[model samples]
Target: MTEADFLQLPDLAARSLGGAVVYANDEFFASRENLISPGAPDFDPSEFGHKGKVYDGWETRRRREPGHDFAVVRLGVPGVVEGVVIDTAWFTGNYPPYASVDGVNLEGYPTYQELLDAAWEPVLDRVALKGDAANAFVVDDDRPWTHLRLNIFPDGGVARFRVHGHARPDPAFLTGTIDLAALENGGDVVACSNRFYSSPRNIIGLGRSRHMGEGWENARRRDGGNDYVVIRLAGQGCVDHVEIDTSYFVGNAPGSARLSGIPNGDAMSDEPSWVELVPRTALLPDCRHRFRVDSPTPVEFVRLDVYPDGGIARLRVNGRLI
Candidate 1:
């Protein structure tokens, strides 16, 4: 895959879904948690402390002796990494000159020592990096990874480490009814009409919206066309129920919404025919609406259409895998 292709992949390390930097060999200058901070890195020239300049990312002390510094991160979801973005934004001089990444697939919780001893496979070989820039790298491996180890040569600072990949859900976990549209469950927002205020992908994110910012919101549409988002399920399934939440969208919630489903095997074309699952129904602001699906046909994808454009907090598609 090309460097541009990395832009299309999902950031598997976004903090919104609980991705974390679990372990690090050293973080003397900056916190490791900053490596997975949501959104872009920020900088304030005068934002300095006693330790050093306050950076918006992981910064280790300069290596005077021995091996390089490293940090281990648990992915938000187990998936095949397609690329990575190691941003050194706002860390021009203190940024590491070179870096490498490795991956592992072990399940369950392992100790830091155990993780260090795990059989790690290289995802990105030692590569040069540019300071104060988003360093993008393509991962050729197709293996599903649960964790990642980032090694910085001779130690320094890194603004962010983004693992971009496609989710790979295990079929064995699809035993009972589950939120097939949940991001943690491997569902993906493949396409969307608008995401002016917030990302459409947030509608399928794990857990309820903690605040208005955690949900998806679109700009006010002056045109006639309504905003919509298409979601590819974790697997082909028969949708049993659907939940549409507009919490924290008191003044800008959609007037009404509709749901459609497409059966498996059909390519997601620009204008694929969709079978109606939920008819046009009115929605109230800051409320949750649940609907039972009457359609019996199993579907691989579902599209949610909000009437005349507005914001939606969350969308849950409860279904059983086919």
Candidate 2:
């Protein structure tokens, strides 16, 4: 996939996604926790800390010695990394000249010292970086990794770090009824009619959206049709029930919606033959709507159609793996 497409993948390192900055060799100038903060990095020229000019990124004291600085991050969704964005926004003067990343697979809970002693394999070799830029790199590895180590050459600040990749949730925990379209469950919104205002992926986020911006939203549709999104399930399953939440979407909720499922796990996504899961139903603004699926056929993909669309806070495809 292209860099922009890779960006659509889940940020496995986002703090909101349950990731953590477990350890850092040094964060003398700034705290290490800022690395995986949600949203874009911000800057206030007048902001300053005691030791020196305050930075919004992880920073270490200028190296008088001969080693680089690094931080270990535990991924929220362990999976194969497709790419990374080392955002050095607002760190023009003190940004790192070079950086690299390493990955390792671990299970259960391991202490910081144990992670430090674990075997590390390179995910992205040393790459050149630009100050105040979002340096992107595509990793070609296919193995699922649970943790990552980001290394900055010598010493400098890096505003943010994003590990973009598909989620590979532990299959052992995916048994019985579950949200088949949840990002943490290995499902993804692969296609959509429009995502002008916000991403459709948010419709299946970790939990209920706190506001309208946290949900899937489309621009006002002028012509005839409507807006919709196609979600690929974690696996082939029989969808038993569904939840459509428009909470916090007071004025922009879709007037109505339809749900359908595709049994073709390997067939093309655009196949015309789709089994009806739920017929067109009226939806209330800022309310949670639930429906029972009468279909019995197993499906790997499902499509949700919103009539003359607006916003959808969350979608739950609770079902059993077949």
Candidate 3:
């Protein structure tokens, strides 16, 4: 019964009849927390969290500044509103060369001929997109909008924000959703099997040794971690690397491997935990699908140890999860 008594959102006509209300605004793209976007499904960005947003000021400074990041809501609830979907799966903000709102006075212009003398209409169809790769304008055309007004300029970043139409049970439509592996236990590793690629001329015995048995042998270059493969992004993020495929391996495709994780330090236990292994890329045995594991400080679990050749078949988490 909070989040402003469930976004009572401009009170969508005092609610009740049919329900719907989806508003989010913590700026920083709705405070991203596990939101991957690419062909979706099994879509793991690391899980996701933080279920609270809906700005217009004060909630301890609703994302503070730049007009408190913006988020005026008031979705429908009393039937017949028709359409309204605006999921930018993940979008950030930083526009000011031009902008417009008028009634609410968001007007700002400095170029584009003063933004066509201040007309501003296409806020990119109101905004929506999910990302891990393979992207496109997810939604913004489905229009009905009882009342919304994102508007942010001074660094914004969002992850997900669905609001399909058909109104009826306004419990504030429960805002964004992100579940991070049911909340922690990324330990008993389970998937990322049989991937391939290698050939300096078939580069000696390299076929997953009949099924990952013989010293787990599948070497390409060789560094140490006895090959590589690890994931823990059931939560936490800001990572930006990881995508791999060799088409099935054997030789001369080893140039990079070794990535560690967990580093926000001081959960304390004798304190020495500060893992971080780097080596983003370099295994282009003619490349195949995708690979990245660059970090900018924000982790939860990840380990890709394969000095010479570990093995892989599928692993992607461009954002969200941890």
Error of 1 at 265 (Å): 4.3
Shift in Å, residue 41, candidate 2? 0.8
- Model 2 misplacement above 4 A: 266-270
- lDDT of candidate 1 at residue 57, scale 0 to 100: 94
Give Cα distance to truth, residue 226, candidate 1, Å: 1.2
RMSD of each: 1.4, 1.3, 20.9
Model 1 TM: 0.96
Q: What digit string (tens of lDDT, one per residue) describes model 1 on residues 60-145?
A: 99888988999999888888999999999998889999999999998777888899999999999999999999999999989998
**lDDT for each residue of candidate 3 in 167-248, tens digit (9 for 90 to 100):** 3332232223321111111221322222333211111111212322221224444333445444444446555554444433
Model 1, residue 110: C-alpha shift (Å):
1.2
| Model 2 per-residue lDDT tens digits across residues 78-164 | 999999999999888788899999999999888999999999999999999999999999889899999999999988999999999
* Candidate 1 Cα deviation (angstroms), residue 172: 3.2
Residue 294: error of model 1 in Å? 1.5
Q: Rate the local accuracy (lDDT) of all candidates.
A: 0.89, 0.91, 0.34
**Clash-forming residue pairs, model 1:** none
* Positional deviation of residue 126's Cα in model 1 after best superposition, in angstroms: 0.9
Instruction: Give the distance in Å from residue 167's predicted Cα in candidate 3 to where it truly belongs.
Output: 25
Better of 2 and 3 by TM-score: 2
Give the residue spans of candidate 3 off by over 4 A.
1-260, 263-299, 315-322
